[model samples]
Target: MHTTKRLTGAPGIYLLAANALVSTSAYALNTGTDLNLSMKPIAGGMAGAAYTNPQEVSAALFGNPATLTRFKSLHFELGAGLLEPNVDNTQTNDGYSHTSTSAARNYVVPDVAVSGEVLPGFVLAGGIGVDSGIGADYRTSPVNAGAGLGLGGAGAGGAATLPLVLELLSFSGNLGGAWEVTPDLSLGAALTVGFGLGQLGTTGSTTGLQGLSGNFGGTTSSVHNISLRGALGATYKVAPEWTLSTSIKSPLQYDYHSILSTTVNGYEQWQSVKVAQPLEVTWGVATDIVPNLLLEVDVAWKNWSSAALYQDIFQDQFLTMLGGQYTLDAWQFRAGYSYASSLLLNSPNGSLGGLDGVGTLPLNTAVPGVLARNDLTKVVQTTLAPVVWQNTLTVGLGYAFTQHFRLDGFGAYAFSENTSRSTLALGNYQVTASEWAIGAGANFSF
Candidate 1:
C-alpha cells in the first residue's frame, strides 16, 4: 500500500495490498466515519440540521451540546466545506480490466465556534474542526505485485508506480458546558480532542500492505495520533412546536504507529494498529410543522460489534437522517436525507466467504486483518476499504444579512455505489463509488 518478486511467498502477502489495513479508514458521507457532517454550513443546509437546529457556535458545540442552552448572547461562527469523491476501482482478472480514479478527490472542511453568556443560564462552549479525511486515490494504479494483483498506474513517460496511498485526516476539539435544566430542560457536555493523520502503505518503492491478509513487510508506514473523547446531551421542549433530542458519543481509539514496514517471509517486518470508534447513540425529532415549516429527525446507533481495531469490519449499524427547513423573511430553505446500514457481516453478494475457496494466489495464507471471519479478510475488504455508499441527498441555503449577520450553504449527492467481488483468489473485483459536496458558512451575533 510491500517488497517483491511475486512478493516472496503466500501471495507474497499481497505486497503493499489492503493499503495500511484501514490505516485510518473512512470515506463516508454518513456511512462509516463521518467526514464533517455538521459544524454548520447551515447543517450543510439541513441534512445535518445541527441536532436541534442550532446553527452557530460550532454547531451547538458539536451538534447537541444541549443545544448550547439555546444561546442567548454573543456568538460567532465560521465554516467552509468543499468535498469531492468519485472513486472508481476495477480489478478484473480473467479478462484483465483496470481502471482507477480517486485522487482522493478534493476536500476542505473548516469551522470555528464561540459561545458566550458563560454564567447566566450557563452556556459555555468552544470549537475547532476539520473532522475527517483520507479518501483513497490509487496513484495512477499501474503496479502489479503480480500473482495477479493487477493494480494500475496509467502513465505518460513518468509516474510509473510506487504511490498507492490510502488516506485519512482527522481533527477535533470541543470543550463544553450548556445547562438549562428547566425552561423545558436542557443539558450538555463535551470534551473531545481527536487528531489522527495517515499515509498507509507504499511510496516510491512500494512498502507493505495486507494488514490481515498477511505480509505487511512494510519498511514503516504512518498513522500519527492523539485521541480522547466524550459527548453527552439532552434537550426537551416536548411541544409548543416539539423538539426532543439526545446524544452520547465516546469511542474513538487509535493506537497506530509505524504501522507497516514489511517484507515478511523475506524479513523487514514491523506492524501496529489499534483503531476503534463506536458506541454512539443518538435520537432526535424536531417539528415546527407550520409557522415557517421546520422538520427534523435523526437516529443513529453504530455499536460496531463493540469497537476495537475497527470492529472486525463493522456490524451493529443504523443511521438515518431527514431534514427540512423553510423560512421566508430573510430567505432560508433546505432539505436533506441520509441513510446507512450495510457493513455486511455476511457477504451481501460480494462473496469472499473464504471457507476454503477464494484463498488462492500467492496469498500465502495470512488473512489476519480486520478478521470478519477471514475470507482473505473479505478479499482484503472488497479491495481496500470500500465503505460502499448507502445513499445521500441534501440541499441548502440561508441568508440573514443583518440582525447579527448570517449566511449558510449546502449541497450533496451520493448515489452510485457498485460492489461486485468474487474470488477464487482474485477473479472479479469491482468497486465503484460516487459522491459530491459543496459548502459555505458565516455568522456573528452580539
Candidate 2:
C-alpha cells in the first residue's frame, strides 16, 4: 500500500486569548450597602447606583453626585486585586486543540477617591478607579487552514500554519458632586472617562504544500478616547428603620479612534477605526432587614445594537456579497443575599443577547465561488449563539481585621457559550470554533 504526499505552505492561525475582558475586571453586584467598599456599589452587576452607608457613600460618587452629601470627613479608598481566569473548550467536526494558559496575578488594581464638606448642605467628591472594561483572555488555535492554523500540515502538498496571538487590557475613572435639598432628599451627578488596549499578530508558513509557502505577518493596536456621563440619586426614609434609596446614571455615548498598525514581509501599515459603545441604565432598592444585615437587587441594560467592535473580511469573494453589519445588546438582572461576617458573600448573574434580522456567513466555498449566508437568526433569536451572550455569578466575602484595615475576597463564575455555526476560506476548507470561561479576584482597603 502507498500513501500520497501533500505539499503545502505555512498557514497563519489567529488565536484570540482575550475576546471578552469587561466582566472579569469589574466589581460584583450585591446590595446598596456593599457598594460602599472598593468595588461598585449596589451589589449584583451594574455601576449606576449609590451606597447605603457613609464610608461606602464616597464610592458612590462614580455613579451619583448627591451621594457626597452623606459624607462628613475627607475620606479615600485605596486598593488592588489579582484576576485568575480558567477557560476550556470541546470541539467536534475536524476539531483541534487550541487552548491557552492564564494571565492571573498580572497586576494589583487600585481605587482612589476623596470627598470633602464644602459648606453646610453641599459636598464635593472625585476619584480615579479601575473597573473591568471587558471579559477574560483566551487563546485557541483553530484547526482550519482558512484560520491560518500553523500547527501541522493538512494540505494538498503538506500542511500550512499561521501562528497568531491576541492580548488585551482596559481601565476607567470618574469625577463629580451632590447637594442636599430637604433633610430627606439629595440630588447629584459626575463625568466618566476610560481607555482600552489590545494586541493581535500572526507569523509562520505552510510546508511541503502546493503553490502556497511564505513568511508571516504581524499587527498590534490600541485605543484611547473620552466620553461624557452623569447620574442622579435620591433616598427617602419611608419609615424609621427602613430607608428607600434609588439612583440613575446616564448612559455614555463614545466616539473612539483606534490606532492600528501592521507589518507584512518587514513592511508596516497603519489604519484607524471609529466605533461606539451603547448607553447603559441601572435601578435598584436596598433595605436594612435587620441590624447590620441588608438585602438588595438591581437590573441593567446595554444597548449593544450600536456597532460592530471589529470588522470581517473574506478574500477571493465579491465585496458586494457582504451582508449588513451587527452589534451587541444585553440586560443584566441581579439579586443579593448577604451575611455581614468577618466576610461578605454576594452572587449575581443575568441573560443578554443581540438584536434580530442580522446575517452571517455560515458556510464559505471550499470549492471557491459559491457563497452561503444565514440570518444570524440562530445568534439573534436564541438567547445564546451565532452571536455570544455571557452570564456571570459572583460570590464575595469581606473580613475586617482591625479598625483601620480590611480585606475583601471575590470568586466569580462567568460562562459565554456561542451557538452559531460558520466556516471561512483557507486552502479551500471550512473552519469553526466555540468557547467557555471562569474567573476570580480579591481586594484590601485601608
Q: Rate the local accuracy (lDDT) of all candidates.
A: 0.61, 0.34
lDDT of 2: 0.34
Taking the tens digit of each residue's C-alpha lDDT, what string does model 1 give over 1-446?
Answer: 22332333354333323331222111111114565354358777666756775656787787678888877698888887877877676655545565655577777888888887778788887888865564565545632222243333322221112344566677788888888878888888988898877555544433323323333222335668889888899989877789888888888776665554443444443445556667788888888868998888887787867776445555787878787888899988888888888764555212121111211122224434412224334434444566778888898999898989888888888788887655443345567777778888888889
Q: Number of the top candidate by lDDT?
A: 1
Clashes of 2: 61
Each candidate's number of clashing pairs is 31, 61
Alpha carbon lDDT at 317, candidate 2:
10
Taking the tens digit of each residue's C-alpha lDDT, what string does model 2 give over 1-446? Answer: 11112323322322111010111111111100112222432222222223432224335676445657766466555444443333232222234433222222243445566777788777777777654432222223322222223323444221233233333343456777777776767777777675544333232232322322222222224445555556676655556555455555554433323233322232333434433333434444455555554444434343333322311110011000000101112211222222111111011011111111100111111122311122111111111111122344444444445544444334333344433233222222211222222212222233
TM-score of 1: 0.33
Worst 10 residues of 2 by lDDT: 314-323
